[model samples]
Target: MDTDRAAAVDPIDVEVGFLTPALRSDLLERWNEPQRRYHNETHLRAVLRAVDALEADGEAFDATEVRLAAWLHAAVFDPTESENNERSAVFCERVLDPSAPVEEVARLVRLMGGHRVEVGDLNGAVLSDADLAVLGSDPETYDTYAADVRHEFAHVPGERFVAGRIVALEGLLERKSVYLTRAGRDMWEKQAHANLNRELGLLRAGAAG
Candidate 1:
């Protein structure tokens, strides 16, 4: 099992370093919500770790803004809802520290809606790559992630879940490159393509079966 379970973390978790205690607690509450499976604290920690890894690998960006955006990017997730990114951005605006780059952080949070960071958007690129780093995970880890995501939408019927998931996976496959930052591409792009293609094949096989 993935070691970073939400149950293992305290509600007052301060692992993200830059957030205020109050804001961190609130964000934890939102992320650790019972309905969350894939988007839980585990996902949040993975993204933050990816951000740190990208920086260590020489991907330059404003660390504070990107990390802050990472913490709040999915702060309003709901498996049944499509506007979680916008709602998360609104939540960021409502609670982020004034001294922080409020608008930039919110913009980064919003960008996760599509993971489509435009060129010249250094912060957006970093955040998008970090958020998507899970795609390049080893096969075992990627399988676990896929299963958790399926559980997140357990409310949906299996047929609907398979159909929607196929579309999402195909969309990523169609992208020229899954990761925006050079380090991200070097580290995860090929593996991400492999993982996505493998999952797509499994889904297609199941659908045909």
Candidate 2:
């Protein structure tokens, strides 16, 4: 039997309840953890809203799965830990949908690491693009986000963080397009590039100083 193909028939069973009250409370607790400055409910909601907007205006497949991915994508965020995505994906897989393509859910969650998706994978494209929509945010919003991110990594020294941040920004700049969905590409690609370049320049100058 083609299990993967059969599971694809129902991408997201949104109507089927999954997030219990206990689960919701646990999720909120993690988001509200003291160590988190940026990967909190606010950022999660922003990504959720971005997904909503994308669904309303663009092509998004397996939307329920994408929405669930939004909830759990940053669930294990830790500035000091490198396995946040992997850890989060594992947890999400266990809870997302057992009968469905749960591993597929994990795959999408893992993609949050680089925000990269196969060209034809709309589920991945939508989720990844929505997660990165912040990059295309207006200057003021983007600045606030940057500040929040630095706060998240508060344990790190300013110089070290800035140097690392510049490296990350430069990597983003090198991407052909950070936002992969059609809506993302049309609405945010140019703005995202401009934002990335501007930040990289500022961070580079700061590092030099």
Each model's lDDT comes to 0.87, 0.79
Residue-wise C-alpha lDDT for candidate 1, range 92-116, written one tens digit per residue: 8888777779899999989999888
Could you estimate the TM-score for every candidate?
0.91, 0.86
Residues 5-116 of candidate 2 have per-residue lDDT tens digits of 5334432222324555566667778878888888887887778767766776747488667777777787887889989999999888766646656777789989988776
TM for candidate 2 is: 0.86
Best by lDDT: 1
Model 1: colliding residue pairs: none
Native-vs-model 2 lDDT? Answer: 0.79
